[model samples]
Target: MFTFEIFREEVITCYKEKKQQHKLYSQLENPSPGNLRNLCLIIFSNGLSKEDTQTFNEFFNPLNQSNELETSINRFDLDKLRPLRNFILGKAKNPKDEVVKLLAILVDFQPRPYENWKKSNSTTVIENDNVESGEKDSSEIEAEIPVNTEQAITALNDANSLKSNSKSKYLVVTLGLVLLLGVFLFIKYGTLQKQCMYWNNDRYIAVDCKEKIPGSEVIALDEHKLNNFRRITRPDTLSNKDVSRVWYSKVNNSVEFFTEPGHHPLYDKPLKAVTAYILNQHALEIKN
Candidate 1:
């Protein structure tokens, strides 16, 4: 867990100072071309256009009414981070406007290890250094399972000969049944997928959530198996590809919402609900 309170203070403090500096630069209604040139350099170096300087500066100025800088900064707010991101960015707020959010949930959100850590009856295989020491990690075991195939050319040839003469009526019947079961399952899975994505676009961060984020914070989730988390379990957002997002429950045990590209954290719900959900679901706890 991060010192969220400390990070919040750092963000507020930095913003206050930067806001003061921005006030000074902003006080000038018309800056000289040389100053503008420097500003232009800043923009170009940061991949912004010279023509958009006014808009960019204003956006970063907090006091600016409207600009691109504003839109970009809006995306980097803490409320937009995943539980894992909350553990990585720490308390420092970068001055840059283009802070691309990456999906690194393992950097934050540490969970308690499972109680029974040594109950494995199966041994993980080792590629090298195979010795009397039988201890191995999960990676070794996963690798070993993929290489234990038995060669079946002769058996396959015999089976082919047997099938060439025998009517194989039983095989045809079994295959037909399997085909029917597959279709039925496909229909059921389609229904579940829709339910998983039911709440994707409904909960606006402004209403359904209460994320009072101050600045960049990183929440580590080293042991949390994010990949194992199923997409909404019911029917999900109908995405064509796999997606990841930091999500918190909407109505306690009810469904959760995800952020696009990466995860965003939500707050301000009752503590009991958040606590129960984390302990029971969310994978906030580490599993390593």
Candidate 2:
């Protein structure tokens, strides 16, 4: 019995078969540029039902006047592109489907598929200058339509803001790392290079010198190699006798050496005088 349910089922089966064929077409190994046109022709001739063929003809009749089929395909409305895109997606998702065999024949044909259109509920409203028998002007209709964009606009703004903040953080981190690296290199290499010095004995040494007054203890000629002192006069050049005791006089600002006070007239005067030290070692010894 030819019931309404059976008729509806047959229509559904026809659509399913069309989808399967489209999937095969997408997976073709190599197809000529005219493969889609030829396939459409074949569908018109044999694949489609009489009603479907009639609908297809009505849709494409105006495009027949144009020589460029690609241009006509580009002008396809969302209603027409949705089914084709879904078919291609179905093929991509299922590699082992029997319908994938058609890809071998349609491989050479390249078609640009519609992207992100599946999620949109946007409608294309036609605007005609001439009003139909009872229809109002498209301008008035368009004015009455409300556009919903809050969610999309907010999502887009948030994404852009996040990207900008990420870039700023990356730049700051890179600069900070570079600055730290420079400081580390300076501390390790620059300070060592500056510390190097040549001693009076023609030997290299790292002298730990500091700023001080010339007459202070820190500036004295000493045995330590790291000291900043330099020997100006030798001990032997100052006196011929053995002078064990050395005193520095503030009035003369010179080193005065004292030998045993013998019965010499020069005992009141210094036996040896040098241009460098100033110290009262006798008081320190008595105190100790």
Candidate 3:
């Protein structure tokens, strides 16, 4: 009545038990050829009556090695048990009864089945817990990255502050040196000064502190454009005419250089007034 797959499963289970018990030995409770029939009959007897079932079950029940002797079945002995399985269905009324008989015989000899189930399920739970712990470790690793970045940014800000302060000091020193040089040039060669005034109606030059209009075809120059020439000793040579000279130095906030000794003359154009302006300057070496 049983399929080939069901019969194969029983045989495999029987073989695994035989491996554990050591094939070379025989157990005390293991039924020999004389009692093998009697053992099958006992399990088969369960459906027959209550009293017979109890006595038979206690007779052939497999015992654990700690408290009882070991029994083993080789390939030949296990094959021998297969024939007894057929007898179990001999008087059964239906296929369902036959299947029930097979399951009862296979499982009856297994002791402490609940203990095995509990251990297997507990091992699965431990494996699942290990996976969750790995996820927690990964999140902690991600957390440290931002902490490392913040520390780097703090160090960079400190370094930039130090550099900016140093640059400010250099700019202050350079500006102070430039102002000092301009003052020194002003005092040395700026001894002569004069002013030529021009009215809205006409222009004139002051001769011995007297304003006079030119009676000759002499060009006029303004104070704004008369500072280009710096090395002329005589003012008359600039325009080939009689010119006058004056020194407005030691006066009211005034300095000048365009002056002639004889008469104040005019030029064809207001050009470079070549006089000494202290053009050459000595360089100073910076000591580190």
Candidate 4:
């Protein structure tokens, strides 16, 4: 597995080190699926140096084309990445360490079964050639020297026992590590979920629930409100007529309207533009 969460953490750490404002920062802060895809595109499109760009283009031909780059980034195409990894390893200096890390993850996502197969095939071929040339096989030589069949059987059984024990130990260790990782992730996610903000004067700002302010009202964190923070993107098709003075929550059986553009404040949903249909259908309700 690529371990996207680890990769994301690395990217954020690197971004913090740079301490510069960029599209990558925004994507990191709110890593929705679309934002993550855009983050990859932004890194490739703008983050690479001149030499790195040339090298990338050389390995992934015609990646200068927007569509080609988009497809490669979207898929994390390993077929196109393995060569790039080899090239980077052979390079004298690699300025883009993040890109190198990404390539490493993508290229090493799966074990190369073919390498093992090739080694096995070569050994078999060499053994066949020796037999054809009338060379005594190791088995044949050992057969003449083996005087104690019982001892040989006992040794073979012991070897198999050791191998079985080793496999059992490995499996146990692997399962233990997986369980630890799961517990860590669960704790981390729970902490993030608990991180909520209270609506201050005009805008919401995160604060310690334990601290008390003298004059101003100090409200506790509301997970629902924090989770519902909306990032509205205006559609290109939207017109003046479709736009309204107030925002509207998404229609269910009944439409609820808001005075401003944000979340529903109570529901786990975002507020969107009040369409003409909502205006007409809820006209009687709005007057009251």
- Which candidate number has the best TM-score? 4
**Each prediction's TM-score versus the true structure:** 0.15, 0.21, 0.21, 0.26
Better of 1 and 4 by lDDT: 4
Candidate whose lDDT is highest = 4
Which lDDT tens digits does candidate 2 get at residues 1-288?
233333323333444554454433321212333334434443332344444433444444444765543334334443543333334444334332112222211221121011112112122112122223113333344344444577556655655665566568679989999999999998767755334333333212453445332332232222222332233233343331212222222224443332211111112343332223222232223224
User: What's the lDDT of the predicted structure labeled candidate 4?
Assistant: 0.48
Candidate 4: stretches off by over 4 Å: 1-196, 200-207, 212-224, 231-273, 277-288
Candidate 1 residues 100-170, lDDT tens each? 11110011111111111111111223322353232233234333443324434544544455444334655
Better of 1 and 2 by lDDT: 2
Clashes of 2: 8
Residue 218 miss distance in model 1 (angstroms): 25
What's the distance in Å from true for residue 261, model 4? Answer: 9.6
Better of 1 and 3 by lDDT: 3
Q: Can you tell me which runs of candidate 3 are displaced by over 4 Å?
A: 1-11, 14-111, 148-288
Better of 3 and 4 by TM-score: 4
lDDT of each: 0.32, 0.35, 0.36, 0.48
Provide the global lDDT of candidate 1 against the true structure.
Answer: 0.32
Residue 226 displacement (Å), model 1? 8.6
Per-candidate RMSD, Å: 24.3, 42.6, 57.0, 18.4
